[model samples]
Target: MSFVRMGIVGIGNMGSAHAKYLIQNEVPEAQLTAVCDTNPEKREWIRSQSGDSVQFFDTPESLFESGSVDAVMIATPHYSHSELAIKAFRRGLHVLVEKPAGVYTKQVREMNEVAAQSGKVFGIMFNQRTNPLYQKLRDLISSGELGDLKRTIWIITNWYRPQSYYNSGGWRATWAGEGGGVLANQDPHQLDLWQWTTNMLPKRLRAFCGFGKYHDIEVEDDVTAYVEYENGATGLFVTSTGEAPGTNRFEISGDRGKVVIEDGKLTFWRLRISERQFNKEYNGGFGQPECWKCDVPVRGVETGHKGITENWVSAILHGTPLLAPGEEGIRGLQLSNAMHLSAWLDNWVEIPLDEELYLEKLNEKIEASTFVKKSQCAKILDVRGTF
Candidate 1:
């Protein structure tokens, strides 16, 4: 209740990064009181890095039962996110989970349910939501300034990862260890931002995924999904970790105009008149609506992960609304799961997907996995400019 005593439940790359910021007092109104990790070396490393003043626990249960933290940030693996978060909620502590929610929707749904009944602040680490460029884009679409949306396309392939990056962790690309590859790890932020900015969910989708295409991994490294929205709008989402000098471009077209974000710039092409109106009124057979190109100015800085953590702390203290509520985490996860299921089944899969079938298929992949990963060296990369 005072200074929002915080505990982090993973001392991996992201957890250590958060610890450094909280220890450095970057997140106002928050204090790193307890750190939890199953690895003794990681615990000792964090202790050495943080002056040995912070409490260390070998398990999340111990950390939760210690009464040392008013809130907990679950930064563990994809499989453990929901279990740890549910436990935090049971202990009457605020919960902030790292993205993708979990490997599947069933567990995430259960976590959301427990969170709803707990009456505690539940948030997700969708740090990209704090980016001013994405915030501006969401505002534009939500304000209806772009008219009725017609189509969306995002080719986000800038998530390039080398073999050593995956080799650094045994759980990097395996189906049983990390669930899926790029979709589960590298592209969750973009996937979350895709639906968050558009404020739309696909009705159904068909996907093509290339498993072990670019690495000695068991999960997907390349993906292309075609989606159909409930409002008849369609979308094409393409992503890969294999291509170098890749592109990250997102475009949304509407009846009034089109908005595009690419290469750190936002561009808007405003039609003098709505395309729908122009089409209905035009007498000429070949004429089109006149368009004027405008540069959309996004004012403000990109705050990244620190911004989200501070916002979560502020929300717990002040009754402020969360930028990315934990309940909504399932939305982006649903999209990712749907794509994976579609590719696995080789057919179009509907939203609110067949959870049982997906789980069965995932388990099969886990059982059939023949990948043998090298010993983990566990190098912590500087993730500041990666996003």
Candidate 2:
């Protein structure tokens, strides 16, 4: 195909924003040929916004069967990601899905298997992967510039949301709807980046989650999780939607040095010698390894959703490798599920978590939910600083 004929499912905030970007010629390789949403008002709004150049469909199945698009982007709810992506792949259309893949790993696994058999280019909207700062961090760790990893601490609580925000959507922050709260909605990028940059997954994790601590929602709004890697390295992840003017600091320590990303700045502490070597050879009782403070320079700008869309288009047209493959989406979702399961069980959960137990507990929450959702007009905030 000379240019990808793209269709977008779910005309919500993210989907509409992507449609506008494509229509305005932001992604030159993609054309907004078709759109689908269950709501007739959303379809009319998109047609009015973009003129009659785009086709609107009432159901995703009709959009897929109409041969209007060669690729599809799924921006639907948390649980529908896998189902929509699998349908796209089965229709011989490339697929790009938004983050968190799915609420649970089991469904995501099935989606991945179908994509593998279909031989379609499947990608996930891990837009943060396009950030230059994170790219530099991944390179440093992978190149062994930091020696062996020791610890990681990320206090990411800048995702403050008022009660009105949660009340705007009936599907939001509900066990039977969106799955989980901040971890599913706001923290997926950070969680994805954690394992992506380190190139490691936790062997076990123990989490303390405060359900409805900040809002009237039934899901978790505050969490603190302690994770352990197989190599004896440990980590701490703390996040919440309640704290105002909160911090977004990520610090990683290794035997050779340490790197810290905060306030949009990347800093590094370079050790003169490896800590293990220094400890083995040093004779002095009180001296530690010498270090030099350095500022890690990151090249290029932070290209968010637009960059990922362009990359997805390139992958479909020219066989360019995807920045975030759809199969890898499960890794981050696994971490989110593990944290929730650990909190529910009140104990440490191992990697490749017990999926059956997780599903059982999650179903219990859904069945026992007594949360009375409020009725409020949906408001789509400017999601610039939230990322």
Off by over 4 Å in 2: 371-387
Q: How many steric overlaps are in each model, in order?
A: 0, 0
Clashing pairs in 2: none
Candidate 2 residue 119 Cα shift, in angstroms, is: 0.3
TM-score list, all predictions: 0.94, 0.95
- How far residue 308's Cα lies from its native spot in candidate 2, in Å, is 0.5
For each candidate, the alpha-carbon lDDT, in order, equals 0.88, 0.89
* lDDT tens digits by residue: candidate 2, 280-364: 9999889999999999888998789999999989998898999999999999999999999999989999999988788777767
Task: Estimate, for each residue in 68-137, the C-alpha lDDT of model 1 and write its tens digit.
Answer: 9999999998878988898899999999999879888887888999999999999999999998888988
Instruction: Please give the lDDT score at residue 6 for candidate 1.
Output: 97
Q: Which candidate is the best by lDDT?
A: 2
The number of clashing residue pairs in model 1 is 0
Q: Against the true structure, candidate 2 has what lDDT?
A: 0.89
